[model samples]
Target: MNSVSRRKFFGLMALGAGSMAMLPGMAFGAAKAKTSAPGQTSLAAGQAMARIKALIDELRAEGRAFAADALASDNNAQWDRLLNHYFDRKGFASISVNAANLCPSLKPVNRMAALVRDLLEADISFPMRGELAKASLGHGLTAVKDWFGLGGSDAKADFLLALTANSTMGNNFVNNGLVTSGFMDPQKDNIVVWDVNHPTNYDAWMYRKATQGWGADSIRILKTKMFASSVTEAERKAGTIPSDPQNEDEIIAALLALVDERTKLVTLSWQSNECGMVLPMQRIVSELRAVNKNIHIHADSAQTFGVLDLKLGQVDVDSIAGSFHKWPCGPKMVGILYMNNKHGAAERFTPSIWGYDEYINTPADYGFAASTGTIDPNAKRFSYLGQQNDATLVATWMAALFHTGQLHPGVTPAKIEARIHYLGGQVQQALFKHLPKVFPDFTPKTAAQWIATPTSNARLRSSVYLFKTPDGIVAGDVMKHVYEQHRFAIANLKVMGHDLLRVSPTICNNAKDVEDVVAAVVDVILAMKKKTLANNTHTRSYA
Candidate 1:
C-alpha cells in the first residue's frame, strides 16, 4: 500500500471499519489504482482521514528541539542544558510549581511526539504494529519494575500493568479484590481507611462507591482523636492542646480498633494528598496483619511513587496503584498497577476487561467451540485491552530513563528525593517564619495551626505542603491571584471542610523558584488583605 492508503487503512481500522475483505481491490502494494471502488468516498472514510491528518498536524506542531538536544548530547553538562531549555520551553521560565497535581516537564511530551511522528509517517503493516505495541509495553513494564528496584528475575514475583489513570487502577482493585472476590459479608465485613487526612478522590471515594450498596455500616473510617473532634474547643482556647498534632500513635490505635475478623480490606494513600503526611506503612501493615492475616492491604502511591525511594520487594502490601504524570513527570493518561504474584495475590482477581488473552474461539466438529484460554497469572492478564497507544508506553520508558539517570546523569532516585524534600523544607520554613509576620492578627500562631501539613515529625514530611489561609481570605482566591498575576501555579483545595493552599516543588524547580514562590504568596496575601480592608471601610462610609 502507498502512504496515503496505508494511513487511511490504519485510520479506518481505528474507527472500527470492517477488515480488508470489505475494501475491494485494495491491494497491499498494487501498481495500478482502481478508479471504481465500493464506497471509497463514504463519510466514515472522510472522518478517518481527517482524524489522522489532525494527529499528524499536532505532532508536527510540537517542539522537537528538546528531543534533538537529548539525542545530540553526550555529557552531563549538555543534558543539564537540555533539561533547562526543555523546562523554559514548557512555560516554566518563572516560579511556577504544580508538581503535586501535574508536572510541567516536557521530557515525556517530546519523547511521545517523536515516536508518534515516526510511526505515523512509516508505512507499517498491522502485524508490525502489533509487534511494536507489545515491545513498547514490555519496555515500559521493565522500566516500572526498575523504578521499584525490582530485579529482572523478580518479574514472576511482581507484575505491573498499565491503565488510563490512577483512578481506574484503584477502582479495579476495589471491585475485583474486595467486592467481586466474594470475601465481603456486607453485614459483618467492613473496610478500614485512614480518614483523618484527605486522600485522593480515587482512594476514598472509590472505596465508598464500591461498598455503597453493601450497607450503611459497611465502611469504617480510622481517624486521629484530634481530627475526630475528641478534643474540646475549650482546651484549644486554653492552649492546653497542640493546635497541630502528630498523633500517629492515636491513628494507629484507631486503625487497629477498627480492624477485626470482619475487616476484609484496608486502603490508604502512602502519603496524604491534603498535606504531605506520610503514613507509617510498616507499622500499619504489621499490626493489621496481626489482627487479621487474611486482610488485603492496598496503597495508593500517587504522591510517593517517583519522589520517594520505594523498593517494592521490601514492601509487604498486596497491591499498589500509582500514576506517572505527577512525580515521575511522565505522559498523561498512563498509570501503573502492581500486584504481588508470589503470594497468589494476582490470581484472586479476575480480568476486568476481556482482552486478547481472555479466551480462544475454535470450530468444533459439529458446531462451534469457544473455550477459555489460560489467563496470564501475572500483570499481563490485566493489560489485554484491545488497543492502546504504543507511543505513550514508550514515553513512559523514556521518563523512567530520564528519572533513573540514564538520560540525565547524576539524576538518580536518591538525589531526586533529596532535592524535593529540601525544596519542601525551604517552603515550609519560609511560610512558618513569614506568615506570622505578615498577619500579626492571625491567632493561634503555631506551625500546625497555619501549616496544615504535619511538620513535628520529620519522617512524615513529603514534597507536598499545605498552608491554611488567614481568616477572611479564601485559599482558592489566593491560588488564582498567584497564578494569574505572578505566573505561579499552585493548588487551592478544600479537604474535609478545611480550605488550604498546596505547594509541591519537583526536580524541575530550584532554590530561586522556591524564594520567588514564597515572596509571591506573601505579596498576594498582603494585597488581598489591604483590598478587603478598603472595601469594608468604603461600605461603612456609604452606610
Candidate 2:
C-alpha cells in the first residue's frame, strides 16, 4: 500500500476504536437476526450488506455537510482543503486515465493512484537524494567534463571515475582504485568541487568546531563570497524590498566570504525574493577561472531550475545538481547534474574496486566502467509500480508527451511558474478577504510573507504557500479534516521545523482549484474559531 493508504487505514482504525469507546452500545458484539434460524447464512449476508451500505451513506452525508461548511465558513487555512478541494478531482481523473492505459499485470486502477500518493508522500531524504544521484551519475560526470574543458586522457579518466562513482555506493571505490592507483590522480583537487554552501559548509564547520584544540590559526580560511550588492533599480521602483537585500551580487559575495579554502567549498543561492536579486555566479566563475583554473564550481539550482532559463555557458558552472521533482513535476526518481570536463575531483580522488589499469583513457569504455556497479539494490526496490509497469510507463510517457506537446520545453517552465505566481496572488487575495474576520490584523501580503510570519521560510519552498493557524493547530490534523470532510488532499510542508498548510498548484490545477483551496482554508479557520469559542465558554463555566 502507498503511504497515503497506510495513513488512511491507521486513521480508520483509530477512529473506530475512539467511536466504540464513545458509544459503548455501538461496539462490536452479537446482533439480533431477523430469521432466528442458525442456517440462514444468506439472510445474514444480506443484513451485513445493508449495514455496510448504511454506514457508507452516513459517511457520505457527513462528508457533504463538512464540505458545505468549508464552503460556507471560508476556512482556507487548512492543508486538506488546499489539496483536495482544488486539484484532487483533476488529479483523480489523470490517475484514472493513466491506470487504464497501463498493462494488466499491475492493478492499474489502484497502482496509478498509489504512485501519485507515493510521489506526494515521499520524504525528501538522503535515500531519495541518492536515488537521484544513481540515476544521473553518468550525466553529471559528462556535464562536469563539458564545463571544465577537460580533454584527451584526462577527460577519459574523469569519465571512468564518473561511471565507477555512479555504480558504487561511496567515493572509496573511486578514491582507492582510481586516484591512489596513480591512474587518475593528476586531476585531483583541480577540477574545483562546485557545490552550494549549505548543510555541507555548516556540517563541516560543526565538525571542526566540535574538535578539541581546534583554532582559527590551524585552518587557512579564505572568505570569498558571491552576491549582489543591492536590490535592482526595478525592484526598488516596484517597492519590493521589504527587509532583506535582494541583490544576487551581495548574496554571492557573502557566500564567497564563508568559503574556507582549507576544505571543499560550496556556494548556495536562493531564487530572488525581490525582482532585483542578481546572481554574480557567471562573474564568480570567470574570476575563479582566471585566479586558479583548478577550482570546480558546483551549482545547486534546485530552487531556480524551472523558474529560470539558465544559460549554462554564461554562468561558467562546472557542476550542477537539481531536484526535478520540485519544479519540473517529473518522476520522483529523476534529477539533473551537470559537470564540466575538468571537474572530476570525486573520480580522481575516489577509486573503484576494479583496477585502474584495465580501463584506458576513453569516454565510452571508461564512462560505463566508472559507474557499472555502485547503485544501491534497495534504491530502486519497492517502486510504487504495484505490478503495472507497462501501463505506468505508457502513462508517464503520455503525461510527458501531453504536457511537453502542449507547453513546449522552452516555454513550459516559465508558463507554469507564472501561473503558480498568479494563483498564489489569488490565494493571498482570498485569504486577506477572510482571515481578518477570524484573525484580526491578518494581512498576508505574499506567499513568502505568510510562511515567514512564523519563521517557516527555511522549510517551505517558493512554490508552496504555507501559513500557521493562530491557535497553533497541527497541519496534519487540519489536513485530515479537509481530506476526509471534502474529498480533497492538500499537502503539508514539513521542512520548516514546524507544521503549516501548503498550497501548491501545478499545471493540472487552474484558478478555480486555487480558489477552492482558499475557500477550504477559510472554512477550516472559521471552524477553529467556533471550536475555540465553545472551549472558552466551557472553561469559564468550570471556573
Candidate 3:
C-alpha cells in the first residue's frame, strides 16, 4: 500500500479530471465571498490541498502507521481508512478547502468549536494529543460512575449528530425526557418498559409508545433474550456458562419490575449491537438511580462508544446517545448527545432549538434584545436541528482530531477499546478453530467467553462476535460469498433470531488480521462446500 498501489493509485487518477473535482467530498470549489487575498485564503486552502495531494498520496499510501488502520483483516483497509481519515492532511487546513478558499470567519469555526469544547472537557486548546482521555462523554460518564457505586449521580455532557446510538437520537431522548420531566400524571407516570429484548433498543422505546405522548400505557415488554457465551476449557472445566435466558440479575429484575411511581423513562444499550453483550450499564444506571432519582436514563451507546472506559461525569444518567462511526474511528454524521444539565438546564431546558431567537432561554438580562435569543443550558438544547454550517461545523474539528490523538497518535478511544476487547478475542479463537473445517454448521462462543476479565467466570468483553448459519446458508448469501470470495469485511447480523456471522474487531487489528479473517472464513466455507458436494452428486445423477 505504501508504494501507491491501488492499481497504481487508479493510474495516477487519470491525470486530473479537474483535480478529480476536489476528489468528491473535499476538494472544494463552491464557497463564495469574492475578494481574495489575506494569505489568499490560506493559499487557496493550501492550493486546494495541493491538488488533493494525489488523494493524500493515496491516503499516505494506505496507512500512516495508524488512524485505526482499518480494523484489519483489511476491510479494504477499513474502507480506505474511513476515507482517508475523513480527507485530512494537517486536518485539511482545518477543513476549509476552497469555498472560494473557505473560512469566511466564524473565527476558524469558533476555534474548531472550542476544539470540541476542549475535547469534551472544555476550555480546550488542543494539546492532549496522545492517550486521548479528555472528556470523551466526560470520560465515558466517569467510568460509569466509579464502576457503579454511582458516585453521587446527576450527570451532564453534550454534543450532537447521532443516528444508531438509537435512531432519531433515541426518539428525541424519550420525547425530550417526557417534555422536560414534568411527566404530567398518566396514572402517575406508571409505564415506560423496554426489552422486546433489544429489538434495536426495543424499537426505540417502542417508537415513543406508538407515535408520541408516550402512550399505549406509556410502553411495555421486558421479555429479554440476546444470548452467546458457550464458554469452554470443557465449559471452563464443567462450570458451564451460556445459560443466558437473560441475565444481569434477570435484566435488572426485568427493568426493576417495570418501575411504577409512574416511571419517567429508561432507554437501554450499554452493549448489544446484536449480542456482543455487555449490558450491566453500571447496574442499569445504578438501579435506575436507586429507583427514580427522577428517572429518564437514556444510554443506547450504539455498540458502546469508543470502547468503554466511559465516565459521563459519574454515570447515573439523564441522557447520552452515541455514534462517531462506531468504536470511534469518527465521522459519518458524527454524534454525541449528553443532556443532564439538570435536564438541559438553562433554567429547566425550554429551547427546543432557537438559533433565530425563541430567546434561547434568555438572561443576558434580556437587554440587547436578549442578543438575538438564547438557549443551551446543556446537551446543546438538542444541537440546532437545522441550518448551521461552518464547513460541516468545522468537520467536527476534523472528527475531534481523529478522536483526540490530534489526528494521529496512532488511534485512541482508549486504544480502540482495548483493541476491541483484546483483538476481539483473537478473532473469536480463530473462529473456533476455522469454523468446524469450513461449515459443518458452525456455532461458536466461549474461549472462556471472550476473556476481557470480569471473573465469576468472565463477563466484560465486547469486540463483537457470532457464527451460526451453515445449514441452508443464506446469511446474506454467506455474507456475499465471503465478501466476493475473500476480501473479507465480515458481519451479517440479526442476533437471537438467527442470521449471525458478525466477527467485530478494530484498532488496526493485529494477529495477522485475525489470521487473515479466519483464513478468509476458511476460503469462504470451502467454496460453499465444493459447490455443495457437487450439487449432491448432480442430484443423484438426475435420480
| lDDT (C-alpha, whole model) for all candidates | 0.58, 0.35, 0.44
TM-score, model 2 to reference: 0.46
Worst 10 residues of 2 by lDDT: 95-104
Specify the highest-TM-score model's number.
Answer: 1
Alpha-carbon TM-score of each model against the true structure: 0.74, 0.46, 0.33
lDDT of 3: 0.44
**In model 3, what lDDT does residue 49 have?**
25
Clash count, candidate 1: 1
Candidate 2 residue 323 C-alpha distance from true site, Å: 4.1
lDDT of 2 by residue, 435-509 (tens): 566566555433333432211122112334445555655555555555555545565444324445655554444
| lDDT of residue 301 for candidate 1 | 79
Report how far residue 57 has shifted in candidate 1, in Å: 27
- For model 3 the local lDDT of residue 507 reads 48
Kindly list the per-residue Cα lDDT of model 1 for residues 156-228, writing each as its tens digit.
3214554444545644645554555456766668776665433443354445556555676576665432222
lDDT per residue as tens, model 3, 103-200? 12212223344443343352111122111211222222232223222334544222322222223454455454454545534434554434423454
